[model samples]
Target: MAQVLFLGGLGRSGTTLVERLLGEIPGVCALGEVVHLWQRDLRDDERCGCGERFSACEFWRQVGKTAFDGWDNVDVERVQALRDAVERTRHIPRLASAAKPAVDVLEYASYYARIYQAAAEVSGAKLVVDSSKHSALAHVLRAAGDIDLRVVHVVRDARGVAYSWTKRVARPESDGTDEMTRYSPGRSALLWNAHNAAFGLLARRGVPVRRIRYEEFLADPRAGLIRLADFAGITLQPTDLDFLRPGHADLGVGHSAAGNPMRFTVGRLPLRRDDAWVRSLPAAQRRLVGAVCGPMLRAYGYPLNPQETR
Candidate 1:
């Protein structure tokens, strides 16, 4: 049985760091956001953050070849056929295993497994870390019963999430998926609130998860990594600490190395990504977040400032 580790949480919650650290573990391949089926095309506009056009990235190309080989010979049309089979069926991944030629969800899982397997062959990893960050997909994998999975429930303050959203909007190649609209500061705080709340409830029920705070990770990465390794049942190397350092000189080529989705480091200044929300947010924005997320902030250990309260 393959072991799958999911680094799931809101978009900017240090999932990349977790994925990178896990990748360092022998036999673990961290495929950062390789949600191949979700996107329309591999060559579509979105960058995989692997320093390559996703379709053309050599590593992913090999991943597509060896890992996704079964589908590789299927041609574009066959890939489409597989995709259409998914769309028509009510259960996206449920009937995946039953797809024509008997492609089950495990095969789908295996395709990614191949990617990790190949990466492991090259990088000497034993597990594959997937940072898709989708709760719905997590449920689907749980249903498939294909791999032993552990979910790292990473979280940061809502304001921090909002701040990260602001930075993304400023970038040229951003996904522009209306995350702000989905969870607009005040009114949409439900998106973040419910997301965090779900993790809390799951943890309380003993859902085999480990909670990691973005603040704490940045403050003392060594402690965070130690706890994370314990949860994943892996040991860390002394060199692992070097990878978490400021300049990111430790990460080798062919790795994301402190980039989006699959990178991490302890910054020299070491500030929380959400810190700017306090200084950068306008009164209206602050009011918006306060209305929906005031209680959530307090729950997450933030002090309540009366002016920002509902």
Candidate 2:
């Protein structure tokens, strides 16, 4: 089994960036949102991170062939349905303790194992990063118990996440035909509570977990990347840190299956914290988010009023 660094968090909370950073490491391959692999990558034939459609991308085509004997042998619809049944928030509690799983759960987990193993073999990576951004799926993988998994629970301030979800950003991988889904502040806050709490529970149940706040990561990316790399069992060489020069990152292309539009962005990108929600989010909405997410917000060390927050 390949060592897996599973980035679990709410959507729009910078999992894509962290996953990309991890993928930049020499022996790490980033597979964007494996939870969406069946529907988004396999069925929809969306673009890969390297600018080729799924069917045409030699990397994923090889992954299919190696994992399932052939891509054509995979039943996309059946796998998608299995995902729905076994990977849901409601199933996490039971899954965490299920010594033996139902037949469907085992089957779903086997597919994931094969995919991760195939990805590692094809890319020649020691570890693979999966930024699936859901507690439920993390629970499923943890419960399945085959992969060597570690969770990096990325968290951002609820207000910023809510503000991000409100934006109508285009999904460039979808050929601009679709947009990222929007969520109201209330719904986003509820999700922030649910997702974070779920991961917290996962940790309490003995899963090795590291919590990274997005603000802290942006505060000093080099330090953050070093910390994460160490956690992922990779020792860094000086040249590995060369990509981080001054205040920017020199990013190269990858073959990620699905992620934010940033996945397609290569070359040097400026490094800065996006704190627009601090000044941009409406006061009432901020208050609403604070009220809904008060417990975890405090638990995660976010300021309630955010006087000088990033």
State the lDDT of candidate 1 residue by residue for 35-93, as single tens digits. 44335235343444455455555665565566546334534454445444432224523
lDDT of 2 by residue, 107-207 (tens): 88888888999999999999999998989888877755668989999999999999999999998976678888899999999998999999998898788
Segments in model 1 whose C-alpha atoms lie over 4 Å from true places: 24-27, 36-48, 70-123, 168-183, 200-206, 246-249, 254-274, 306-310
Q: Residue pairs in steric clash, candidate 2?
A: none
Q: How high a TM-score does candidate 1 get?
A: 0.71
Per-model TM-score versus the true fold: 0.71, 0.97
Q: C-alpha displacement of 294 in model 2, angstroms?
A: 1.0
TM-score of 2: 0.97
